[model samples]
Structure formats: C-alpha cells, structure tokens
Target: MAHYRECPAYDVFAPNCPARLVLERLADKWVLLLIDRLSAGERVRFNQLRRDMAGVSQKVLSQTLKRLERDGLVERQVYPTVPPTVEYALTELGATLGGTVERLAQWAESNMPAILLARQLYDQCGE
Candidate 1:
C-alpha cells in the first residue's frame, strides 16, 4: 500500500515561493562543486573531496556537506575504525541532479573563452 500526497506546484520566480530557498542553496559555488564532484556515483572521503576541490577551506567544506545532507541531497556515512571513517555520496534525489550539474560545469568550462571575450568587448566599447 502506498499513500502519496499531491505535490504542490512550485514557482521559483515568485519571491515568496518555498522553492526560492532551495534555489538559493543550489546557487552556492561550494554546493555546486560538491554536487558536481559526488556525481561520479561513488562515495568519496571527506579529505579526498577537500583535496579535489582546490580553494575550499576545511571549515567551508564541512559546513557545505552538512548543509547538503540536511537538504537531502547528500548522504553521510560513518564507519567505526581507529580514527573513524566518513564518506559522502549522493542520495537518489541528488543523483537525479548530477547530470544537470555536470552539464552546467561543462558549459561553464566550454564557454568561458567566449564569455571573457564578451566581457572584454563590453568593457572596451559597450560603455
């Protein structure tokens, strides 16, 4: 037996929409990087993630992980060991977003040159 409530329609453009809160979280650069990293479909150690995402401070990574976990986009697992082991992985919901984030990252990388040129032109003549 399954009981499902009808989900409400979300209008992200509405200032008062609850979806705005989620969009706000997803807009964060750290959050985007974390999501893009974990999209690989493997649980990664905290230290490994920190190493891979350069420029992320230890504190910021920790806080971002906590926030993602709270939002149901990440799963945190702990294994009892000498020093204890912790890893992060994407939840099913998060997995659904993986491809989208990956595409966004790729788009940024591929279009950066054009964007830079556009900015330069704007600065030089579009005043």
Candidate 2:
C-alpha cells in the first residue's frame, strides 16, 4: 500500500495537488449554485435544479451533477416509473461541503452590496 508520505510530491497547497482538484470542482459556478440550492435538504429533480439555478442550461446542470456524483459529493437516485424518476441529494461528504458552501454563500450575499458599491465608486473615481 502506498502512503501519502511515501509520495515524492504531496504538497496540497501546490497548484497541481490532487486536493486542488476538489477545489477546482467546487469552484465551478454551476456546482456552487447547485450545491447552494440543494442546501435546503430538498431532494431536487433535474428540472427543479434547472429552475433553481437561474442561468444554468440543461447541458451544464447535467455535467455539473455528473461531476458532483463522480466526486462522491452528490447522490443520484433513480426510481422506476412511467417517466423514470431521478432525484439528487447530498451525500455525507456533500453535507460537510454544503455547510461550508452555505457559509461562503452567506458571506457573499451579505457582502455583495458593499462589493458592488465599492466597484461603483471605483468606476466613478476612474481608479
């Protein structure tokens, strides 16, 4: 068995670290948006996700959901039915991330007005 210490290159902070891959995955706009929308503990359907995420297209949502599933952050459950029901919920790992993401979302929401004001002021000042 290979241990992390045995690896010659195991710097997580390095730009190319495997850990960075998780960051990159979560850093996506759609992923963040979807995760935020799903934070309410709602078992969201594909169309529901599409509706909740304002600007996300079906292709993008599908791709984002697939990536999240691959990363073990999102759980996809399929039910047999006439139309074939599909639902998405956060996995245990995803729940952990959801809390963090929700906090970040709250921060962004709280500060956006100020940030926009600063941008406006900067633009007005030609700075």
Candidate 3:
C-alpha cells in the first residue's frame, strides 16, 4: 500500500495547492446556495434549483452542478424517459459539508439583527 506524503506547510498555502481549489469552489455563490438547499435532503431538478436560487443564470448553475459532481460532493442522476430528466442530490461528503455550512448560516442569521443595529448606530454617528 502506498502512503500519501504529508505536505509541507509552505506547499499547503501555495496558490497552486489543490486545497485552494476546493476552498474557491466551496466559496462560490452558486455552490453555497445549492449546498444549503440540498441540506434538506430533497432531490432537486435543475429547473427547481434555478427557481430556488433566485439570481443564478442557467449557464452558471449548470457549471456549478458540473463542478460539484466532479468533486464527488453531489450525485447527478438521469432518469430513463423519452423527454429526458435529471436530478441532483448531495453525497455523504456533501452532507458532512452541509452541516458545517448550516452552522455558518445559522450564525449569520442569529447575528444579523445585531449587525443591522450596529450599522444603524454607526450611520447615525457618522462613522
């Protein structure tokens, strides 16, 4: 069995590191939205994802789904039918990530009121 070599600290932070690619992909707007939606365990059609995501374009959504599938975070299923049908669902890895994203979302939601109040106060104080 071949053991994977541990990356040096410098290599880990290099721009070309594979870790950076994962971070960039996960931080994208469409990926974030899709992951959030899929956290509910409901398999969604492409059109349904577009509708639920609000501002995403068809092209962008298609790209995001493809990337997610490639990363093993999402599973794409094609139904056998005359007209053709496709659905997307999160894989186990995706589900684990969904929990982390959910926590971040919850924190943002919980603190939004405070953040708004601070913003109002700052505006009134001219700072």
Two-way lDDT contest, 1 vs 3, winner = 1
Give the better candidate number (1 or 3) by TM-score.
Answer: 1
Candidate 2 to truth, TM: 0.85
Q: Listing every candidate in turn, what is its Cα RMSD in Å to the true structure after a full C-alpha superposition?
A: 4.6, 3.1, 4.2
Model 3, position 106: C-alpha lDDT score: 87
Model 2, residue 73: C-alpha shift (Å):
0.3
Clashes of each: 0, 0, 0
Q: Write the per-residue lDDT of candidate 3 for residues 27-114, one digit (tens) a residue.
A: 8868988998998997899999999999999999999999999999999999998777999999989988998888878898999999
Alpha-carbon deviation at 111 in model 1, angstroms: 0.5
lDDT of 2 by residue, 1-127 (tens): 3343443575767655576677889889789877878877878899988887888889989999999999998999999998999999988788877888888889999999999999999999995
Superposed Cα deviation of residue 4, candidate 1 (Å): 20
On lDDT, the leading prediction is 1
Deviation from truth (RMSD, Å), model 1: 4.6
List residue ranges in candidate 3 displaced over 4 A.
1-12, 118-127
Better of 2 and 3 by TM-score: 2
Candidate 2 stretches greater than 4 Å from native? 1-10
